[model samples]
Target: MAGSTLDESVTAFLKNHASNDAFEETDPVKASQKLFPEIAYTDTEKAELSQWLITASHVGSNTEDAAKAAERLSTLNTHLSSRTTLLGAKPSVADIALYQHLASVVSKWSAEERTGEQGYHHIVRHIDFVQNSPLFGLKLDEKVHIDADNVVFKIKPIDAKAEKERKKKEKEAAAAGAVASGATPTTLTGDQGAEGKKSKKDKVKDKAQAAGDAVASTVVGKPGAPEGAPTKKKEKKEKQPKPQKAAPVEKPLSPSLIDLRVGHILKATTHPNADSLYVSTIACGDPPGTDNTSEFEGQVVRTVCSGLNGLIPLEEMQNRKIVTVCNLKPVTMRGVKSCAMVLAASPRVAEGEDSHKGPVELVNPPADSKAGDRVYFEGWEGEPEGVLNPKKKVWETIQPGFTTTDALEVGFDVEAVPQLSGEGAEKKTGVGKLKTAAGLCSVSTLKGATVR
Candidate 1:
């Protein structure tokens, strides 16, 4: 803070954003409400602003209490978790007060302190948004450099509508409390308390169903018609054994059971809720109306979420060809459901080592290949299953065999996975290079690495 943390926010705001008319007002509170925010703060929000201002004033004082500051900041962080600003997507003077007191403090924090499990992540994000975002229009020279990709813990964002509903319920409950004290609740009315009431349409539907049931009773035999006994005419036919349906012939255990394809990443953005995942729009050659796919920029695309935010540069993920496992059942990651897996290569880590700590490279299909082109381990080529069954664990069993060769080519080494090497296994021998019609799938630098 320029002088004192308490005064800096107003001083900065008055200098940067206040109009000349605001200068005529000597009182800080009135000037703030006059020039700082265009939106009207609710009574509750006004109380919040007053409370936070008192907390901000405590900073750099002999009477300062660290625990109280942490508690207040945490509550504010929770409130801001579901909102873009203190006023839910609209900037307010309370934010400026928060930033002035915490900007220098946040600048000195290590990555762990900024985004670790115990870190004040939402506060850091709030500060960054205030300074850089056009909405606030604050142009301070000394800004904190918080790395967006280095977040250690991911918090699922709270839905704004849910928060509003919760607040509404709290207000209604407060009104009910007044009702208990003999005051009439504005909520009660003739049309209210409809817990068991049916609408006219619903009653009509029920009456129609009852009439149809009465008619159906005539043809279905009277209510007391000896339950399972058939009529004389029906019993006249000879009983015949129905032919048993032939069992489905299961495909032999093979790596080909996992459908792999050459996919083109149309665009990608970091997952809003997950720190280490990328939400991508990928073209996988699916026709229009294909399951789990949506049209994007004139192409049928699947929204895939991959845990590659820090591992892969987001720019490299755009407009690139990579191998993808298409048959894996869609899994919801964070809040987004990933329809397919983006194949990448990472070095074989020791048992206790973090497998995700990478020098990772996305396994690239040949540049000329089109999206949705069939990609398979050469020696195990066959028709891939439509969707691999989770109970079968086919992918879990076969993924260990997926590896990169000494020549940087992606392949399935049969010897590495013994379960797929014998008896009922598909007749595949040695390492089979993964390829499409255009060319081989290869990683840039991670040769002899695991491909998954």
Candidate 2:
């Protein structure tokens, strides 16, 4: 029960018995109801039954009570055996019913020794016999804990409810202390409360210091005390302060070197063979979409070949613009080329599931600029391509009409450019309005607006 518990196996066995049709008519619940029709199927019956078993195993009065319970169990098992075709063969409903009763005693036999009854021993022996037989479909190693009182197996000292109660008590104690000292209780607000909650370890050290002060005061007699009240006091010892190490300083980057712009993904597709790898097409602006509409405004149609093949299907990435690392050099992976890096939110993986790792993004950026566009804090327009200086180019070839000439990255993260509200911006032509799941938006004429 304490380490590497085995209650899961027992639970699985019980659950199977409850659901299996083999126990349809001769189920324990049905049998108990039939025999004790006048007893009334109350909540008390279930609770009492559980208590009886636990009490009998832990501590029962003399041998008489133990014998009576053992006899009742034996009678129940005999009655069940009579109802089914085979006592341990054919795997009938009665066998399932008897098995649970037998397994319960086997699990509780450790503390049963306190009962000081041969009847308890007899019960365990019989359960062991049934379990050892292959026909019964039971195993002795299917251990169950009879002593686990705590349900949540916490591995840490932190418990939410316990912490809440402890804090409430501390607040009351602090208020009481302030009253005794004839001082106003300190009211923490804003920075004060924030500072007070800073270090629990420091709080403990302060409490120890207060205790030492009280002890030292008791050792020193007051000036008005009787002459017979002789006082002896020792010097207060100061706690030794440990030497502190200075933290290393981090190098600050020059503000002029920082780039700050938003880029979008132009295209997406999964690799045909690799579990990962998505090929894509990206446009800095002018992403492809359904038709020209203002609703599809401020989108990028850049291509991105990424490692998100299996996590997201290729068809789902079409015409969807995504943020990207606008400064990375385009590199060729698995024979497919990529231009700028496509940025996306990190993937979330649930327990017992595969990871969904993707790209990263900034909290906010300019609206019009998109994927493949470098975000610089301040820089010249028309920046050079391939920031990372990779060995080969990212793209294989530029295709016509925004279609995948070779294999598509086959995901969202790119689209056509939209109208800019700023002055001097040209009204780009050849693009059309596109309808999306979200609503109407602008799109590029080069590609049909296929929603991923």
Superposition TM-score, candidate 1 onto the true structure: 0.47
Query: Which digits, one per residue and each the tens of the lDDT, describe model 1 over residues 186-262?
Result: 33556543422656698699789999998998867665557688765555767799999999889988998888887
TM-score of each: 0.47, 0.22
lDDT score of residue 85 within candidate 2: 17
Q: In angstroms, how far off is 206's CA in candidate 2?
A: 99
> How many residue pairs clash in all the candidates, one count each?
0, 66
lDDT of 2 at 250: 32
Candidate 2, 1-452: lDDT as tens digits: 11211123334554463332322322333433433232233464444433333333323223447768656655543333222212211222223333454565456555434123322323332344344422243434564443323222212212335656989999999999988754532335766565566476987897899999988787674445576898778789999998898985532222111121244444455665556777665444321221110112222233456766654567756655544444455466666556545433332336776434432221223333333233321111122232422333222111111111112111222222121112244542332221111222222221222221
Cα lDDT listed for each candidate: 0.73, 0.38
- Judged by lDDT, which candidate is best? 1
